[model samples]
Target: MRTEFDFAPLYRSSIGFDRVFNLLNNAQRLHAIDNWPPYDIVKTGEDDYRITMAVAGFAEGELDVTQERNVLVVKGGRADKQEGEYLHRGIGSQSFERRFELADHVKVETAKLANGLLSIALRREIPEAMKPRQIAISSGLSDQTAPLQIEAEKQVA
Candidate 1:
Protein backbone atom coordinates (compact mmCIF):
# COMPACT_ATOMS: atom_id res chain seq x y z
CA MET A 1 0.00 0.00 0.00
CA ARG A 2 1.27 3.44 -0.95
CA THR A 3 0.10 6.77 0.30
CA GLU A 4 0.33 10.08 -1.54
CA PHE A 5 1.18 13.26 0.28
CA ASP A 6 -0.23 16.71 -0.37
CA PHE A 7 2.51 19.33 -0.77
CA ALA A 8 0.34 22.20 -1.90
CA PRO A 9 0.22 23.77 1.56
CA LEU A 10 3.98 23.49 1.95
CA TYR A 11 4.62 25.11 -1.39
CA ARG A 12 2.35 27.99 -0.63
CA SER A 13 4.46 29.12 2.32
CA SER A 14 8.00 28.12 1.35
CA ILE A 15 10.32 30.29 -0.71
CA GLY A 16 13.32 29.28 -2.85
CA PHE A 17 12.85 25.59 -2.03
CA ASP A 18 11.32 24.20 -5.21
CA ARG A 19 14.10 21.62 -5.60
CA VAL A 20 13.57 20.17 -2.16
CA PHE A 21 9.85 19.85 -2.74
CA ASN A 22 10.36 18.22 -6.13
CA LEU A 23 12.74 15.66 -4.64
CA LEU A 24 10.20 14.73 -2.02
CA ASN A 25 7.45 14.39 -4.59
CA ASN A 26 9.55 12.22 -6.85
CA ALA A 27 10.48 9.90 -4.02
CA GLN A 28 6.83 9.25 -3.30
CA ARG A 29 5.96 8.32 -6.87
CA LEU A 30 8.36 5.40 -7.31
CA HIS A 31 6.34 2.47 -8.68
CA ALA A 32 9.02 -0.16 -9.20
CA ILE A 33 11.74 -1.06 -6.69
CA ASP A 34 15.23 -1.60 -8.07
CA ASN A 35 18.05 -3.10 -6.01
CA TRP A 36 20.45 -4.35 -8.67
CA PRO A 37 23.94 -2.95 -9.21
CA PRO A 38 24.43 -1.82 -5.66
CA TYR A 39 26.17 1.51 -5.02
CA ASP A 40 27.73 3.45 -2.15
CA ILE A 41 28.17 7.14 -1.58
CA VAL A 42 30.85 8.49 0.74
CA LYS A 43 32.07 11.90 1.75
CA THR A 44 35.84 12.00 1.27
CA GLY A 45 36.52 15.62 2.29
CA GLU A 46 34.71 18.75 3.40
CA ASP A 47 33.41 19.45 -0.13
CA ASP A 48 34.36 16.25 -1.90
CA TYR A 49 32.28 13.14 -2.47
CA ARG A 50 32.55 9.74 -4.18
CA ILE A 51 30.04 7.24 -5.54
CA THR A 52 31.05 3.63 -6.08
CA MET A 53 28.87 1.14 -7.94
CA ALA A 54 29.50 -2.57 -8.30
CA VAL A 55 29.37 -3.52 -11.96
CA ALA A 56 31.05 -6.92 -12.05
CA GLY A 57 30.28 -8.28 -15.53
CA PHE A 58 30.20 -4.94 -17.36
CA ALA A 59 33.21 -3.81 -19.40
CA GLU A 60 34.72 -0.33 -19.67
CA GLY A 61 32.70 0.67 -22.70
CA GLU A 62 29.43 -0.69 -21.34
CA LEU A 63 28.98 2.01 -18.73
CA ASP A 64 28.12 5.66 -19.07
CA VAL A 65 28.15 8.59 -16.65
CA THR A 66 26.37 11.85 -17.22
CA GLN A 67 25.57 14.97 -15.21
CA GLU A 68 22.63 17.21 -16.10
CA ARG A 69 22.26 20.25 -13.88
CA ASN A 70 22.00 18.72 -10.39
CA VAL A 71 21.35 15.12 -11.41
CA LEU A 72 23.99 12.45 -11.93
CA VAL A 73 23.03 9.41 -14.01
CA VAL A 74 24.96 6.16 -14.37
CA LYS A 75 23.95 3.42 -16.78
CA GLY A 76 25.50 -0.01 -17.40
CA GLY A 77 24.63 -2.81 -19.80
CA ARG A 78 25.91 -4.89 -22.73
CA ALA A 79 24.73 -7.26 -25.40
CA ASP A 80 24.88 -10.98 -24.61
CA LYS A 81 26.84 -13.23 -26.97
CA GLN A 82 27.39 -16.46 -25.16
CA GLU A 83 28.05 -19.71 -27.04
CA GLY A 84 27.15 -22.36 -24.50
CA GLU A 85 23.95 -22.52 -22.51
CA TYR A 86 24.23 -21.45 -18.89
CA LEU A 87 23.17 -24.06 -16.34
CA HIS A 88 23.39 -21.75 -13.40
CA ARG A 89 23.62 -18.01 -14.07
CA GLY A 90 24.51 -15.80 -11.12
CA ILE A 91 26.37 -12.78 -12.53
CA GLY A 92 23.72 -10.61 -14.11
CA SER A 93 24.72 -7.81 -16.52
CA GLN A 94 21.26 -6.68 -17.45
CA SER A 95 20.55 -3.08 -18.30
CA PHE A 96 20.40 -0.90 -15.24
CA GLU A 97 20.07 2.83 -14.72
CA ARG A 98 20.83 4.72 -11.56
CA ARG A 99 20.30 8.38 -10.73
CA PHE A 100 21.74 10.56 -8.01
CA GLU A 101 20.69 14.01 -6.90
CA LEU A 102 23.50 16.48 -6.35
CA ALA A 103 23.50 19.83 -4.60
CA ASP A 104 24.03 23.17 -6.32
CA HIS A 105 27.60 23.93 -7.53
CA VAL A 106 28.55 20.25 -7.24
CA LYS A 107 30.37 18.90 -10.30
CA VAL A 108 31.80 15.63 -11.49
CA GLU A 109 35.58 15.49 -11.11
CA THR A 110 36.42 12.09 -12.54
CA ALA A 111 35.08 8.60 -13.18
CA LYS A 112 37.09 5.38 -13.29
CA LEU A 113 36.29 1.69 -13.40
CA ALA A 114 38.64 -0.67 -11.55
CA ASN A 115 38.16 -4.15 -10.07
CA GLY A 116 34.50 -4.18 -11.12
CA LEU A 117 33.87 -0.99 -9.15
CA LEU A 118 32.96 2.26 -10.84
CA SER A 119 34.06 5.24 -8.78
CA ILE A 120 32.84 8.74 -9.53
CA ALA A 121 34.45 11.72 -7.85
CA LEU A 122 32.45 14.87 -7.16
CA ARG A 123 33.57 18.26 -5.88
CA ARG A 124 31.56 21.26 -4.75
CA GLU A 125 33.25 24.43 -5.96
CA ILE A 126 31.43 27.48 -4.67
CA PRO A 127 31.91 30.71 -6.58
CA GLU A 128 33.92 33.56 -5.01
CA ALA A 129 30.95 35.93 -5.10
CA MET A 130 28.80 33.43 -3.22
CA LYS A 131 31.32 32.71 -0.46
CA PRO A 132 31.05 34.47 2.87
CA ARG A 133 33.43 37.32 3.69
CA GLN A 134 34.00 39.67 6.61
CA ILE A 135 33.31 43.37 6.15
CA ALA A 136 35.61 45.98 7.79
CA ILE A 137 33.97 48.86 9.71
CA SER A 138 35.73 52.19 10.15
CA SER A 139 35.10 55.53 11.95
CA GLY A 140 35.08 58.69 9.79
CA LEU A 141 33.22 62.06 9.80
CA SER A 142 30.36 63.03 12.15
CA ASP A 143 27.32 65.33 11.93
CA GLN A 144 28.56 67.60 14.78
CA THR A 145 31.48 69.17 12.77
CA ALA A 146 31.54 73.03 12.68
CA PRO A 147 31.70 75.07 9.47
CA LEU A 148 35.02 76.77 8.44
CA GLN A 149 35.28 80.64 8.11
CA ILE A 150 37.11 82.38 5.20
CA GLU A 151 39.09 85.71 5.63
CA ALA A 152 38.26 88.48 3.06
CA GLU A 153 39.99 91.88 2.54
CA LYS A 154 37.98 95.21 2.76
CA GLN A 155 37.35 96.91 -0.64
CA VAL A 156 36.21 100.55 -1.36
CA ALA A 157 33.46 101.26 -3.88
Candidate 2:
Protein backbone atom coordinates (compact mmCIF):
# COMPACT_ATOMS: atom_id res chain seq x y z
CA MET A 1 0.00 0.00 0.00
CA ARG A 2 1.22 3.48 -0.92
CA THR A 3 0.42 6.58 1.08
CA GLU A 4 0.31 10.11 -0.34
CA PHE A 5 1.33 13.23 1.57
CA ASP A 6 -0.09 16.70 1.13
CA PHE A 7 2.47 19.48 0.81
CA ALA A 8 0.02 22.34 0.54
CA PRO A 9 0.49 23.30 4.19
CA LEU A 10 4.23 23.48 3.92
CA TYR A 11 4.15 25.53 0.72
CA ARG A 12 2.59 28.48 2.46
CA SER A 13 5.18 28.61 5.25
CA SER A 14 8.39 27.52 3.58
CA ILE A 15 10.30 29.65 1.10
CA GLY A 16 12.79 28.42 -1.52
CA PHE A 17 12.23 24.78 -0.59
CA ASP A 18 10.21 23.68 -3.57
CA ARG A 19 12.97 21.41 -4.88
CA VAL A 20 13.19 19.50 -1.60
CA PHE A 21 9.46 18.91 -1.46
CA ASN A 22 9.37 17.90 -5.11
CA LEU A 23 12.11 15.34 -4.56
CA LEU A 24 10.20 13.88 -1.65
CA ASN A 25 7.03 13.60 -3.67
CA ASN A 26 8.83 11.91 -6.56
CA ALA A 27 10.48 9.40 -4.26
CA GLN A 28 7.16 8.37 -2.78
CA ARG A 29 5.62 7.87 -6.19
CA LEU A 30 8.44 5.86 -7.74
CA HIS A 31 7.92 2.14 -7.13
CA ALA A 32 9.40 0.34 -10.13
CA ILE A 33 13.04 0.76 -9.17
CA ASP A 34 14.95 -2.45 -8.48
CA ASN A 35 17.31 -3.10 -5.57
CA TRP A 36 19.66 -5.55 -7.25
CA PRO A 37 22.87 -3.80 -6.20
CA PRO A 38 23.01 -2.51 -2.62
CA TYR A 39 24.43 0.94 -1.88
CA ASP A 40 25.25 3.19 1.07
CA ILE A 41 25.42 6.98 1.49
CA VAL A 42 27.63 8.32 4.23
CA LYS A 43 28.65 11.76 5.42
CA THR A 44 32.42 11.73 5.82
CA GLY A 45 32.87 15.40 6.84
CA GLU A 46 30.98 18.58 7.51
CA ASP A 47 30.51 19.22 3.80
CA ASP A 48 31.68 15.97 2.29
CA TYR A 49 29.82 12.76 1.46
CA ARG A 50 30.54 9.33 -0.01
CA ILE A 51 28.47 6.78 -1.87
CA THR A 52 29.58 3.17 -1.87
CA MET A 53 27.96 0.52 -4.04
CA ALA A 54 28.49 -3.21 -4.34
CA VAL A 55 29.23 -4.30 -7.91
CA ALA A 56 30.62 -7.78 -7.56
CA GLY A 57 30.52 -8.85 -11.20
CA PHE A 58 31.14 -5.43 -12.72
CA ALA A 59 34.50 -3.81 -13.46
CA GLU A 60 35.67 -0.22 -13.66
CA GLY A 61 35.33 -0.16 -17.44
CA GLU A 62 31.73 -1.39 -17.30
CA LEU A 63 30.47 1.37 -15.01
CA ASP A 64 29.56 4.93 -15.90
CA VAL A 65 28.99 7.94 -13.62
CA THR A 66 27.59 11.31 -14.69
CA GLN A 67 26.21 14.48 -13.12
CA GLU A 68 23.49 16.59 -14.71
CA ARG A 69 22.18 19.70 -12.98
CA ASN A 70 21.55 18.49 -9.41
CA VAL A 71 21.33 14.78 -10.15
CA LEU A 72 24.03 12.10 -10.18
CA VAL A 73 23.54 8.96 -12.25
CA VAL A 74 25.50 5.71 -12.09
CA LYS A 75 25.06 2.88 -14.52
CA GLY A 76 26.83 -0.46 -14.93
CA GLY A 77 26.67 -3.25 -17.47
CA ARG A 78 28.70 -6.02 -19.06
CA ALA A 79 28.56 -7.13 -22.70
CA ASP A 80 30.89 -10.08 -22.42
CA LYS A 81 29.20 -13.37 -23.31
CA GLN A 82 29.55 -16.21 -20.85
CA GLU A 83 30.70 -19.41 -22.58
CA GLY A 84 29.92 -21.85 -19.81
CA GLU A 85 26.41 -22.66 -18.61
CA TYR A 86 25.58 -22.18 -14.94
CA LEU A 87 23.20 -24.35 -13.02
CA HIS A 88 22.38 -21.60 -10.56
CA ARG A 89 23.36 -18.00 -11.36
CA GLY A 90 23.15 -15.83 -8.23
CA ILE A 91 25.99 -13.31 -8.69
CA GLY A 92 23.59 -10.67 -10.11
CA SER A 93 25.29 -9.87 -13.44
CA GLN A 94 22.37 -7.86 -14.81
CA SER A 95 22.76 -4.25 -15.87
CA PHE A 96 21.59 -1.64 -13.34
CA GLU A 97 21.28 2.12 -13.07
CA ARG A 98 20.96 4.29 -9.97
CA ARG A 99 20.38 8.01 -9.52
CA PHE A 100 21.09 10.32 -6.59
CA GLU A 101 19.78 13.81 -5.93
CA LEU A 102 22.36 16.39 -4.89
CA ALA A 103 21.80 19.72 -3.19
CA ASP A 104 22.96 23.05 -4.59
CA HIS A 105 26.76 23.51 -4.77
CA VAL A 106 27.35 19.83 -4.13
CA LYS A 107 29.92 18.40 -6.57
CA VAL A 108 31.45 15.03 -7.28
CA GLU A 109 35.14 14.89 -6.33
CA THR A 110 36.26 11.45 -7.42
CA ALA A 111 35.24 7.86 -8.05
CA LYS A 112 37.19 4.68 -7.35
CA LEU A 113 36.47 0.99 -7.97
CA ALA A 114 38.29 -1.50 -5.76
CA ASN A 115 37.59 -4.98 -4.43
CA GLY A 116 34.19 -5.23 -6.16
CA LEU A 117 33.01 -1.94 -4.67
CA LEU A 118 32.48 1.44 -6.33
CA SER A 119 32.96 4.51 -4.15
CA ILE A 120 32.06 8.07 -5.16
CA ALA A 121 33.16 11.16 -3.27
CA LEU A 122 31.14 14.35 -3.04
CA ARG A 123 31.77 17.79 -1.55
CA ARG A 124 29.78 20.98 -1.11
CA GLU A 125 31.68 24.15 -1.99
CA ILE A 126 29.91 27.40 -1.23
CA PRO A 127 31.03 30.39 -3.27
CA GLU A 128 32.82 33.31 -1.65
CA ALA A 129 30.18 35.80 -2.73
CA MET A 130 27.47 33.79 -1.03
CA LYS A 131 29.32 33.35 2.24
CA PRO A 132 28.52 35.39 5.33
CA ARG A 133 30.51 38.62 5.81
CA GLN A 134 30.88 41.08 8.67
CA ILE A 135 30.06 44.74 8.24
CA ALA A 136 31.99 47.53 9.98
CA ILE A 137 29.96 50.10 11.91
CA SER A 138 31.34 53.58 12.72
CA SER A 139 29.98 55.60 15.67
CA GLY A 140 32.33 58.65 15.51
CA LEU A 141 31.43 61.40 13.07
CA SER A 142 34.38 61.49 10.66
CA ASP A 143 34.03 63.61 7.54
CA GLN A 144 35.71 61.03 5.31
CA THR A 145 33.77 58.08 6.66
CA ALA A 146 30.35 59.68 7.12
CA PRO A 147 28.35 60.66 4.06
CA LEU A 148 26.85 63.89 5.55
CA GLN A 149 28.23 66.10 8.29
CA ILE A 150 26.06 67.93 10.88
CA GLU A 151 28.83 70.29 11.99
CA ALA A 152 30.89 72.56 9.68
CA GLU A 153 34.05 72.24 11.85
CA LYS A 154 34.32 68.53 11.19
CA GLN A 155 33.98 69.01 7.44
CA VAL A 156 36.74 71.68 7.23
CA ALA A 157 39.32 69.54 9.03
Candidate 3:
Protein backbone atom coordinates (compact mmCIF):
# COMPACT_ATOMS: atom_id res chain seq x y z
CA MET A 1 0.00 0.00 0.00
CA ARG A 2 1.23 3.46 -0.88
CA THR A 3 0.30 6.68 0.90
CA GLU A 4 0.34 10.14 -0.59
CA PHE A 5 -0.13 13.53 1.00
CA ASP A 6 -2.30 16.30 -0.39
CA PHE A 7 -0.76 19.72 0.00
CA ALA A 8 -3.44 21.61 -1.85
CA PRO A 9 -5.21 22.60 1.35
CA LEU A 10 -1.99 23.95 2.83
CA TYR A 11 -1.16 25.86 -0.31
CA ARG A 12 -4.49 27.57 -0.21
CA SER A 13 -4.18 28.56 3.42
CA SER A 14 -0.55 29.61 3.68
CA ILE A 15 1.06 32.52 1.90
CA GLY A 16 4.74 33.41 1.47
CA PHE A 17 5.85 29.91 2.44
CA ASP A 18 6.45 28.41 -0.94
CA ARG A 19 9.99 27.43 -0.05
CA VAL A 20 8.85 25.50 3.02
CA PHE A 21 6.30 23.58 1.01
CA ASN A 22 8.81 22.82 -1.69
CA LEU A 23 11.26 21.47 0.86
CA LEU A 24 8.64 19.19 2.32
CA ASN A 25 7.76 17.86 -1.09
CA ASN A 26 11.39 17.29 -1.92
CA ALA A 27 11.93 15.42 1.36
CA GLN A 28 9.01 13.13 0.60
CA ARG A 29 10.47 12.36 -2.80
CA LEU A 30 13.89 11.57 -1.33
CA HIS A 31 12.57 8.80 0.93
CA ALA A 32 12.06 6.32 -1.92
CA ILE A 33 15.53 6.81 -3.39
CA ASP A 34 18.24 4.15 -3.35
CA ASN A 35 20.60 4.03 -0.35
CA TRP A 36 23.82 2.76 -1.79
CA PRO A 37 27.42 3.33 -0.74
CA PRO A 38 26.20 4.26 2.74
CA TYR A 39 26.87 7.72 4.14
CA ASP A 40 26.75 9.63 7.41
CA ILE A 41 25.95 13.20 8.39
CA VAL A 42 27.38 14.59 11.61
CA LYS A 43 27.05 17.89 13.37
CA THR A 44 30.53 18.67 14.55
CA GLY A 45 29.84 22.16 15.94
CA GLU A 46 27.08 24.67 16.43
CA ASP A 47 27.12 25.63 12.75
CA ASP A 48 29.52 23.08 11.35
CA TYR A 49 28.71 19.70 9.82
CA ARG A 50 30.41 16.83 8.10
CA ILE A 51 29.25 14.23 5.61
CA THR A 52 31.10 10.98 5.17
CA MET A 53 30.37 8.32 2.60
CA ALA A 54 31.74 4.81 2.39
CA VAL A 55 33.28 4.83 -1.07
CA ALA A 56 35.37 1.69 -1.19
CA GLY A 57 36.79 0.72 -4.60
CA PHE A 58 36.15 4.31 -5.78
CA ALA A 59 39.24 6.34 -6.51
CA GLU A 60 39.49 10.07 -5.94
CA GLY A 61 39.39 10.67 -9.69
CA GLU A 62 36.09 8.82 -9.97
CA LEU A 63 34.26 10.96 -7.44
CA ASP A 64 32.93 14.47 -7.84
CA VAL A 65 31.51 16.71 -5.11
CA THR A 66 29.80 19.95 -5.96
CA GLN A 67 27.73 22.57 -4.22
CA GLU A 68 25.17 24.45 -6.26
CA ARG A 69 23.27 27.10 -4.39
CA ASN A 70 21.53 25.29 -1.51
CA VAL A 71 22.19 21.79 -2.79
CA LEU A 72 25.17 19.50 -2.44
CA VAL A 73 25.69 16.85 -5.08
CA VAL A 74 28.08 13.94 -4.90
CA LYS A 75 28.60 11.66 -7.85
CA GLY A 76 30.70 8.52 -8.21
CA GLY A 77 31.38 6.43 -11.25
CA ARG A 78 33.83 3.81 -12.43
CA ALA A 79 34.81 3.21 -16.05
CA ASP A 80 34.26 -0.50 -15.42
CA LYS A 81 37.25 -2.09 -17.23
CA GLN A 82 36.00 -5.43 -15.89
CA GLU A 83 39.18 -6.56 -14.11
CA GLY A 84 37.64 -9.89 -13.17
CA GLU A 85 34.41 -11.66 -12.45
CA TYR A 86 33.36 -11.68 -8.80
CA LEU A 87 32.10 -14.87 -7.21
CA HIS A 88 29.88 -12.85 -4.83
CA ARG A 89 29.40 -9.21 -5.55
CA GLY A 90 28.90 -7.79 -2.07
CA ILE A 91 30.45 -4.35 -2.36
CA GLY A 92 28.66 -1.84 -4.54
CA SER A 93 30.43 -1.27 -7.84
CA GLN A 94 27.87 0.89 -9.54
CA SER A 95 27.67 4.58 -10.25
CA PHE A 96 25.71 6.59 -7.75
CA GLU A 97 24.52 10.13 -7.24
CA ARG A 98 23.65 11.61 -3.86
CA ARG A 99 22.13 14.99 -3.09
CA PHE A 100 21.98 16.92 0.16
CA GLU A 101 19.81 19.90 0.99
CA LEU A 102 21.53 22.81 2.70
CA ALA A 103 20.11 25.83 4.45
CA ASP A 104 20.87 29.36 3.34
CA HIS A 105 24.42 30.56 4.13
CA VAL A 106 25.66 26.99 4.42
CA LYS A 107 28.76 26.29 2.38
CA VAL A 108 31.13 23.44 1.62
CA GLU A 109 34.47 24.16 3.23
CA THR A 110 36.50 21.12 2.29
CA ALA A 111 36.30 17.63 0.85
CA LYS A 112 38.81 14.83 1.06
CA LEU A 113 38.93 11.16 0.17
CA ALA A 114 41.04 8.79 2.17
CA ASN A 115 41.15 5.17 3.28
CA GLY A 116 38.16 4.38 1.11
CA LEU A 117 36.11 7.03 2.82
CA LEU A 118 34.98 10.37 1.40
CA SER A 119 34.52 13.22 3.82
CA ILE A 120 33.07 16.66 3.25
CA ALA A 121 33.06 19.47 5.75
CA LEU A 122 30.40 22.16 5.85
CA ARG A 123 29.99 25.42 7.74
CA ARG A 124 27.23 27.96 7.98
CA GLU A 125 28.23 31.59 8.10
CA ILE A 126 25.42 34.01 8.52
CA PRO A 127 25.98 37.53 7.22
CA GLU A 128 26.39 40.29 9.78
CA ALA A 129 23.19 41.91 8.63
CA MET A 130 21.26 38.68 8.94
CA LYS A 131 22.49 37.77 12.38
CA PRO A 132 20.41 38.73 15.38
CA ARG A 133 21.49 41.90 17.16
CA GLN A 134 20.40 43.85 20.19
CA ILE A 135 18.27 46.87 19.45
CA ALA A 136 18.28 49.97 21.60
CA ILE A 137 14.92 50.50 23.26
CA SER A 138 13.75 53.72 24.88
CA SER A 139 12.02 53.42 28.24
CA GLY A 140 10.00 56.49 27.33
CA LEU A 141 10.33 60.18 26.32
CA SER A 142 12.02 60.71 29.69
CA ASP A 143 15.17 59.26 28.20
CA GLN A 144 15.55 62.33 25.98
CA THR A 145 15.64 66.07 26.77
CA ALA A 146 12.22 67.73 26.34
CA PRO A 147 11.82 69.84 23.19
CA LEU A 148 12.26 73.64 23.82
CA GLN A 149 8.96 75.48 23.56
CA ILE A 150 9.00 78.17 20.80
CA GLU A 151 7.01 80.59 23.04
CA ALA A 152 9.61 80.29 25.83
CA GLU A 153 12.50 80.97 23.43
CA LYS A 154 10.82 84.10 21.99
CA GLN A 155 10.67 87.36 24.03
CA VAL A 156 7.75 89.93 23.79
CA ALA A 157 8.75 92.03 20.75
Top candidate when judged by TM-score against the true structure? 3
**Candidate 2 RMSD computed on C-alpha atoms after optimal superposition onto the true structure:** 4.8
How does each model score on TM-score? 0.84, 0.82, 0.85
Q: How large is the C-alpha RMSD of every model relative to the true structure?
A: 4.9, 4.8, 3.2
- Candidate 2 per-residue lDDT over residues 104-154, each given as its tens digit: 999999999999999999999999999999998876655456476586555
The true-versus-predicted C-alpha distance at residue 15 of model 2, in Å, is 5.2
Prediction 3 TM-score vs. true: 0.85
Q: How far out, in Å, is residue 84 in model 2? A: 2.2
**Model 3 spans > 4 angstroms off:** 141-144, 148-157
lDDT of 3 by residue, 38-65 (tens): 9999999999999999999999899999
* Lowest-sum lDDT 10-residue window in model 3: 147-156
Off by over 4 Å in 2: 12-15, 140-157
lDDT of each: 0.92, 0.92, 0.91
Error of 3 at 82 (Å): 2.0
Ranking by lDDT: 1, 2, 3
Cα displacement (Å) at residue 103, model 3 = 1.0
* Steric clashes per prediction: 0, 0, 0
After superposing candidate 1, which stretches have Cα over 4 Å from the reference? 1-3, 140-157
Give every collision pair in model 2. none
